[model samples]
Target: MGPIRPTIADVARAAGVSRTTVSHALNGIGKVDPRTRERVVQAAAELGYRPSLRAQRLRSGQSRTIGLVSSMPVAVAGGPSKLGFFMEVAAAAAETAMLSGFALVVVPPLDTDPPLDALDIDGAIVIEPDQDDPTTKRLQSRGVPIVTIGPQQGMDLPHVDLRAPRVGRLLLEHLREQGARRIALLMGSGHRSWYVDLAEVYARFAREHDMPPLVVEADESGGEETGREACAELLEKHPDVDAICAAVDAFALGAVRAVAERGLRIPDDVRVATRYDGVRARTSTPTLTAVDLNLAQAAASAVELLLANLKGTEVPQVISNPDPRLVVRESTRRG
Candidate 1:
């Protein structure tokens, strides 16, 4: 059987305080004596008392929770690659918000119905905004303070752009430092703003630096197989290509596997680097070298931006831009 739910009266009796004092202490409402409040809190903690979120919402008419709506899949079935980028961003956002006395409730897809009907969130942070994404528009219409993690075309709202071009330059500079004159880019295929920005950056950088602009399509054969095929093809075409820079870490992992299968040494045979350093980068055989996009920072910035908007506070035109720092691992280091 489950443990009994403790009530406000129980806490009040235990603390020798009035039920009203216990209520005010637990909910963080108007003036209650600090000493009494602390005693009440101790009693509640000892009893493992969980305040009813629904009753609190009804009484205060404001939910203390923020919502996160993701457009990416959260899990994969028996696949080497794990959840997509948005999951990481959501987790980071939740962590920061909870630390600041806010609760984060992640809303999964309804598929048939819109998610708005089911939630009473104070504000929302939408991850990876597309040009035609309706969720942003709908939320804006409802006067919900919404922030986007990725690019949102023509929207005059605060956002965080990952600055993909700068990321490409970082990779190129690393390769150049490792004595690799010939380099290729393995990038995501879909025409999302992030990938588009990455391609433009790779092309512009490669030309200015006089490096070969070899591009590989990120096919949907899953990240591993796609990496194997693309890496093999690039190596065969440009045997002199000493480095491969991938925008997605999943693809980078694929490239690493391909390099291993070819009986080639990393950095010496063909150096590999990527963006989106998550589980795969940390756990890969050689430990991938990647640009840590600072997803947690992005999440905090996005939430604070929305909170400012909700409070009628003047917010800057942009909340956060990608300040990517490169994480060097064995994948790009030469022995």
Candidate 2:
């Protein structure tokens, strides 16, 4: 060999510290005195020493990698304005992971059990896991730490979630307050916890109020087109629905289109509201009344909870219950 690369031991020697101290200072792990850590860092910089990731992992038995899996395919989640919330949440999670010295790998939805052996990850974050999700089951069977972005039905994994039932109630109550006696709900056709919770709460609210409960389900993967079609069908069939609560912004935007096509005026003819606030909600014909789910905060909390679990800390079953903010706009305004 022409030249031997400087190692942690060499840096420790130059800094007059132990090899463990040097390791902690370089990796920002463990507790090292501030002055001593500074000296070790400076020595390592001067020596041009780079620690081997493989060696460190061997010592700690951790891959320092995280997997982010979605029940929906990445392509489907990344498609259009309707699925934009997933992208925003993923971006925030990725940033938080990087700050905590971990790499986040976005894995596409698996048709069958995931091959856990192929992934070198210490933990995983599952988004919108359906009941008995195969990927989640495989990861759990492998004894990997997992945190979900939303509650996973039939799984007791820690999660960071918006209060879906509360959001549904809030939207329905707001519509009722806006003088909508005959209201309809447009929701996704999925068994995901959020969808189930929203549907349950909506039905309960409609029953308590003694208003005829009307619901239309649509394929969320089809984006705005699906919402438009669902809303059109609901209006053509119900004809008397005075208000509509879309479980997502995509559906709300589509409902706006359907209303326009029927030559109806928003708020005056039929009010509309959405569960998740986004760009589409803001720029729609009559800016949508929506519940801001605070996705960024939820995303950050999910990563933090996953990191806590990876660090051998006891994570609570529910790390966060994101409060929904109701934003009233032209869509629900009354003259």
Off by over 4 Å in 1: 1-61, 74-87, 107-117, 132-143
How far in Å is the alpha carbon of 335 misplaced in model 1? 3.1
lDDT of candidate 1 vs native? 0.76
Over 1-335, each residue of candidate 2 has an lDDT whose tens digit, in order, gives 66788988899899999998998888888999999999998998998889988897989899999988777743335444434666677788899999999998877544454566699899998888878567787888788889998899887889987788888888889999999999998887778898899888987898899988898988867767788999999999988999999876777888999999999889999999997677777788899998888888988899999999888786676876667888999999999
Q: How high is the lDDT of residue 86 in model 2?
A: 67
Off by over 4 Å in 2: 1-47, 73-76, 80-83, 108-118
Predictions: Cα RMSD each: 5.9, 5.6
Q: Could you give candidate 1's per-residue lDDT for residues 132-187 as a string of tens digits?
A: 66777877787677877776766766777777678777877888798878888887
lDDT of model 2, residue 115: 63
lDDT, residue 142, model 2 = 86
Model 1, residue 221: what's the lDDT?
Answer: 33
TM-scores of the models, in the given order?
0.74, 0.80
